[model samples]
Target: MRNLASLLLLFLVLLAAGPLQAAPRRDFANQYQPRRTVEVDTRREGDSLRVYLRFPNRIAQRRRVPLRVMGWIDFDARRPLWQDTVRGAARRLRPDGDVDRLSFALPISRLVSGHALSVAFGDAEDAMGGDAAWLRLTPENLNRSFIFIDSLSRPLMRRYVRAREVFGVDAYAPGQTLNAYRYPLSSLAAAPPMATSNTLGQQPRTLGLQDSARFNADQLLRLPAGLYLLRLGNRGPSQGLLVEENRFPQLTSADELIAPLIYVSTSEERQKLFDAPDPKKAVDYFWLGVASDDQDKARQLIRQFYGRVVVANTIFSAHKAGWLTDRGMLYQILGAPETVYRSGNEERWVYRGYQSLNTIFVFRAKPSIFAPDNYELVRRPEHEFLWYAAVELWRKGLIAQPGR
Candidate 1:
């Protein structure tokens, strides 16, 4: 039995170290997977952290399965530095149509400083089922000074504000003057540099300031569509926010609908779609072709594809729209990974592969002055075949639908 256990451990280590294929497995990193039970958002407020948990309304409305909320602070990813149970927090559910949200204020002032804070919610029976979030925390993160959209009631986890929504500034030290600046969204959409490759010290493209404003705690802000930065003063740390038209991450316009098709459409095909007089109709026609004139199949394909577009925008968005980012492209085409592992500055997404092999994609954190959650994919020559193959599977309606 001892020899058998040792061999099994060795096999597991080998699987993790290379591109070996295997069945879907569970890990401690469900935070990176598409959530099914709840969505978590956290922010720093002085010496305290504010956490918001949002779950499907049915979970509360049914009341069949008891729910639990738990959290902890950790220095290394392996062990908890501090842990807490939100006693009876699940009983206080504020319903909002399809979802319900609960808020908690965790005072971390007395606890030892930690690098990451995690909160998880789900079934009381299993103690874990809903969703979890692992947020990077520090002594002086930008969450100290951020804008709150007064007109929006949902969690501000995505840092997205609709154009023309009313917003108010919040700072650790109240009544301080805040400087807000806006910049045009960058126009580049290429695969990120590989792990083995170097950026050649290349800098992100320069963006010109489009607008600026001054405000205080008592002031209200409303801006046109662009990228906005909120800071304490001209030289303070800035919190990046995205101002989008329509409900963001949702495809409502022709441009939003057409942009995500780049992965599957040929150059000529994409140009025609863009040049078409009726873009919505063109998009529908394209999907219909992929579905082979089957209306139901076409509908399912469209729903799954664009559904991922919305989720990509929600979870992976940083400087640009999520569906346009490297991870976004992969998520849109391939759906969620079977397993996700994270470290200080990198993430590894593993998926079941063809034949007897498994596939792994690594993303390195490339935080910039403008986008803190920014990550670049470790691009490779071999990945081109995987990408094209997945695109073909999508076009052929052969890919499984769900968890998009």
Candidate 2:
């Protein structure tokens, strides 16, 4: 009986060792069968090409997969082909090397009147284990190409060319009777004309109101270059309108110009202004109606805010205006900091002990240094407003210091 019991225990040990010995071999096979997937999309500003490679959640005990991307451009055709290589343990294993996203910009000069754009992708050495998809460019598919308009003088044109059957086309000589596309305002349920009295008295004034009126393409084509505010109506649900100055140079063959105007709503506009890098003017505009009651106070506040912005500029001008820069804007709203630290590319701010508030601000200086100076702020997370809330609580004496 004792001998039988010992043999049984030995058998269990052998069973466990068998699978352990085979695990490494399976891992080796997976590493070699790397799988990949990719997608390509183009917007007016530029093209976004994404490649996603999936691998086993665990690779040699590490959570990350290594991927390398290589690409080439067909200058005349304005096309690009990108490829990827899966290396290291990932190459030896058949993890889910499925998807990777890689983005590249095509120069606007490369796009010509008759030329078509195309993109392709595959694994290193043209490996057959992954999937590849290409986006073809044609006059009817203008949206698939990136058309950048960096100047206010440039005409605002649609980035995409729909199916040729969807719209008609006409061509013209440059600087000679520029061709125009017409879109019926009634067809666009989103961009309704505005009727509000709110107008920015500035030279390039901004108008914001609500109204429901049909706008003709001629009106859109004739609008001078500058920001124009439009409101669809004040009665029912209001539709927002944003009319910028310019024409889209790439979609010249198009005769119909209609876009969804999804991002240009009034609320979106206000949110954009609030998140703007230098939002003082926007804030002033928000309170414009009340400025008449206490002009002195309003002026004082504006000066104080501007002063903060100047100080922020002096201290935070790594790449942009002090008030427009991340750290400068945070400092402006949060007032002064209780503690601050600088480390390589990051600036950290700490504000402690105010009611239920504790906060930290981190700014990346190097990246901002390379960004455009006139860039606007578009988003501010909830945590960023904590300092303002803390100040309010501190003033209300809801929070007490540890020592006191």
Candidate 3:
């Protein structure tokens, strides 16, 4: 009787411990899988506008996965806003789900003066989860503010101009009515058509102009050189007008206008920039930012940086490739470690500077078809640049070191 009781107690304890171990392992697996980041670019066509969302190859998998997209357009006060879903490509999840690429497109009619468009992605269903990421589309006459939504209804994640160094634009009409349009000349398929008025309102009739009277450059150029909304009237239905100035232009050159305003807003770019080179660029680009019009220069930068990442991978890669993993490449660029530790599948990289600003890069190794060893950087501390800046500041005697 005594032996039986002891055996039963041991079995129960083992059963309890089993889940404790398994739970963390499962959670770690999910947390480690790389989350996809999206990039959006818009251009105008004849009567329609084409919006393209580019996904990095690192985010796509081998199993069929659906991406849900949603969009909303607000034209004017008189007409109701337009809202609908825009489905994205059905991507396949790779065995590891760590490195895949995919993209989607949405098309709509020409945007009039006062219209604003918003778009986002839906949550993933299965083992993966999806969070809404959005882009707000504004006409050329309005301030070139790109609103990036990390969470809908929540405060904006980033609101700024596009990176002009990477994108270029040509403005036709200089000062008259600010007909300045900015597009990433390198990435755009072709020039988009220009529209005169806002056409997204629920009641298209609100714009008293004849349906056939499309807005021409002459009409658009005539408006006072300021930000204007292409809606109905400024007042009530009785006072139906064609155009109304709402926002002002931020700058003279549309490219200069939108550059700093729009940002990548994700650490993925930095991570990929580290791993993306065929043979990473030298440390030169890291110390020297990328040039605007030089692809060869960018490629050279990648090669240089990637070379060091390869070294880090050779020295640090445990179950995964060093350049492919977070800590490996980060440590390579960041130089010798101040401290290093691991929690489950995640390896944290700590760099101590003037202040205790620690940058954490969380990584996970997952099964994938591309390679036997796959790893991803899942999380990074916010405002990491400040830490690097702090380091520089300390070196320059601009700031005191921590615990000094």
Candidate 4:
């Protein structure tokens, strides 16, 4: 069971790096369908880390499986120091996929900046499809002054100017009747939106959960997805709060389909595609050229190669498309590493590459207000040499080459 937990942790780590739709797709709706996943939100409240697990109500709404999470806090030494668990019995939730949250504050007195915290949901021993994620404790994460949205809640995110950055919504409007404050903070008990505005684009309405009964900006739960500000005592925008859905992964697209070439393309080769009249065809030509003159071989290569792109899309997606990420690039170019080392706050992938040479890549787990699972690649000069050699093999229709 311990071995299984370790493997489960490793799988979740890699899965977190990419998008969650790693399975073979038969329809486009599957991509947009609510994902069966979990998101971790942390804030510093006094001496403990306020941890919130956010998910869609539909996740386990129909199943009898109990939802549970096991977690711990780690200090700067990069090791676990304490562990705790929270479980919720199966229950009904309204409006399928309407957001819901399970929150528990854990002790973090020993946790300073650079420490980490993690949580795993569901039973690992029973082969249940549990999910896990971790966060690196930092002031930016703990210090964000946010209004709690319970009785009206989900993942607690900050109010910002743009929804694109943090997986939330944008401003419904800019100018308002109320004056904006400068660095102001406020709280909400239960309130509704003010009267409708004369604004053309953003009409005033009661924005509830999923915008069902949206009230005013003061109401945390019924807040509409758009641009607004942190108002003081129900005044104007002091600081902008862009709100939108933060936890869901983005669906794949055509542009993302070709983004993986960053790792394989040389500076000159990549420019050719950009300079071409049709960049899409240019991408196809490059792959066909790499396949040497065989259409069948090119088809196989594209299928097998981009298939990895799909998986990478499902696995590495965070702030950007998965293929654009460092881990995604490596996975696309090198396949899965032979071994992966993971802790509460770090990851190391060891790949046995060509000639059985071990090419080791180290990634540091960097938690952000928007993404807790984001990891940064620690680049080394040796990586360039390794990357180019692998590209050369692919250029000759060898790497990730499908069998006849």
Candidate 5:
């Protein structure tokens, strides 16, 4: 049995370290992962690249929370071509509550062949194992040609992509050509949207909404150079550049990312991790056992699988961390859905597995006192087999086929 003495010592250490460096709070109310509180959007322009960061009330209300970030652009074989750290306050970003915006522009030369911009939170790395995220930099396009439009409603996309009441991609959608010009990206306006005609080249759903057509505000943001996740504010995240997340899958701490395992971990595995002096080691060993003793296989599986976990936390956070949300849990465990059907009040995720068999998970939009986009999973006993099989694949280092 684990003794109280060791537990007490660990608690005291965590307590003394204070909020920035404290252990993850169990409340799910007060403490949350950085991804849950902060939003990062990177923009590129020739040798000059701009990064825009958004901080919601969760972070804005807490003045002492680290509101600083450091970035390194890797262009040279030996060292970074440039690096910078940015600091700001929530009040300067906005007058009140529309999500504070912070922007940083850097001079990045097009001469570099392979490039990537790495960014990290300035403090609290030890507490969360990481408060960092990065994206690849592309310079071939000097001007902002691609526009990222998010939270576009379905009624509007019907006019552009002709999705016809289904969540699917229309490669030929002229929404961008027809709509992008109406909604321009603004760090200030906060609500009015502007996008160009070519913006909706493919994706059709909420993002394809006719909001731009309705509001009729034509402020244009020269397309930010690289892929970005666009937020039109107070809605589900939509693809930018039809973008995929770029998460640096480095193994930092198992304790930092233990939520995904709770759905699958055995009682004994849970107990062992709780008692182990180094919880990360215990989690790693459990994965090793799942990998049938192959260390490399364990690392790869952990990286890809947990990469989904990190992505969920980054995108779906509501009242609590995204992973705790019904949609986020399924996302972390099952990977991306084969197709995500979105509307104003609900989101339906469809997953097709081995043999083309399909399972569906529905989340009804339920706004809470804390967050508006919160959702509740429509669960059933039939999910047991699906859940068991999904966990089995993960246990054997396999992944489920979800979607783009």
Candidate 6:
């Protein structure tokens, strides 16, 4: 940790060189989509924020394509507290067909509570593609005890570990007993068409008992597909460290493929899918119908719809599969919002050019024992018309690529 923190001095050298050009602050929808060029993750360790950048095989294979990375502490969406650029070539590049990663740490000793670490990716040629991602952090969460993947030194920002993977719970209060409670993986029900309440209430879900363990420095154990709660003691306010175990966000299981169809399919169509003998065939046939029996169009609809499903799993998976969440429902149907603005504990997603009066959707951050970063959508009756229209586009196989 000390060595990583020391690397922050490199930012000073960048400052002495000259004032680097700044990219435009434009669309931020790409931040929520599946990154095609690279994947990024961050974790706060003591006074340092460790950042990891993973480049896909395709990006790594293009040796001539120069890639640049820049980062800053975003206290608000409008301005930056501190900013610096890092050279991608400074790190060794991997060959094609292999995943390559570049990692560095930034000191956060001066930061106190609320701030987002924003990182932007671009190249020397165009440089105006202001695509960036952010990691929201607080001092308390960093210092407190948390869980992380045993194989990796960072926190589980990906929100999942492969089935049967071993992970460890780092206890802040040593020698005290920490109990682990496991909750079965439950799929979210269909999002209602109208707003019923201001805030969605969370009910106590079924929890299965797991082996009790002492609060050692780190307790490492293997787990199946479920949500695990690590609390300091046996009784509390139901608040604790929640860890979800699953495979990558890709939809592989039959149930996984069938559940998200609720947004695009009618009740009868969904019933047929659920009762079908072969799930894969049923899914293919449903998409075929949506494409009006056109094989090529059917393939496109499948890719686009399921691609958003994969991205939803990447972005919104928390206490449940992201596809089943309220935000996931709109994301899959409407594609990425035209604009996303984040304020204190709430995010407003704006989509322009719609025929309805409602263009912005507000999601309030509702943290729970199972989902620490969970955000619930504020549903409304006015959303019914827009929701059906968007769903109609998907059914007709006319939806464009997200963030287009």
Candidate number with greatest TM-score: 1
Candidate 4 structure lDDT: 0.49
Ordered list by TM-score, greatest first: 1, 6, 4, 5, 3, 2
Q: Across residues 149-199, which tens digit of lDDT does each residue of candidate 6 receive?
A: 455543444556556676665443446565656666665564664746543
> Which pairs of residues collide in candidate 1?
20-358, 21-357, 21-358
Error of 6 at 259 (Å): 1.3
* Better candidate number, 1 or 2, judged by TM-score: 1
RMSD score of candidate 1 (Å): 6.3
Candidate 6 Cα deviation (angstroms), residue 158: 1.0
Instruction: Output the lDDT of residue 232, model 1.
Output: 80
- Model 2 poorest ten-residue lDDT run: 24-33
Q: lDDT by residue for model 5 over 68-101, one digit each (tens)?
A: 4333243112234544445544444542345455
Task: Give the residue spans of candidate 1 off by over 4 A.
Answer: 1-38, 42-44, 58-76, 87-93, 108-114, 121-130, 139-143, 152-155, 172-174, 190-205, 235-237, 354-356, 400-404
C-alpha TM-scores of all predictions: 0.78, 0.25, 0.26, 0.52, 0.40, 0.71
lDDT of 1 by residue, 199-245 (tens): 43464567789889887754777878888777887776567777888
Q: What clash count goes with each model? A: 3, 54, 49, 36, 26, 2
Worst 10 residues of 6 by lDDT: 236-245
Model 3: lowest-lDDT 10 consecutive positions = 184-193
Residue runs of model 3 more than 4 Å from their true location after superposition: 1-36, 72-88, 91-133, 141-404
Candidate 6: residue pairs that collide: 195-379, 195-380
88-204 per-residue lDDT for model 4 (tens digits): 434322332565455666566555665655554445422211234445566555653233333334444323322234232222242322222222111111110111223223522
lDDT of candidate 6 at residue 212, scale 0 to 100? 46
lDDT by residue (tens digit), candidate 2, 1-404? 99999999999998977755421110111111122213233433333322222222232234343343433332121123544444453434333233322334454444543332332233232222112222223232333221112123221122222122122111111122222222221211211112122421222222232332344212222332222222122221111112222222111211111121121124575565556565645555533323444556556544544455445444433222234444444545545555544333344555666345665555443331122111222223545345345434323323313211
**Candidate 4: segments with Cα more than 4 A from true spot:** 1-38, 42-87, 92-115, 121-131, 145-260, 293-297, 303-322, 343-345, 352-355, 365-375, 381-385, 399-404
lDDT of 2 at 306: 42
Clashes of 6: 2
C-alpha lDDT score of every prediction, in listed order: 0.67, 0.33, 0.33, 0.49, 0.46, 0.62
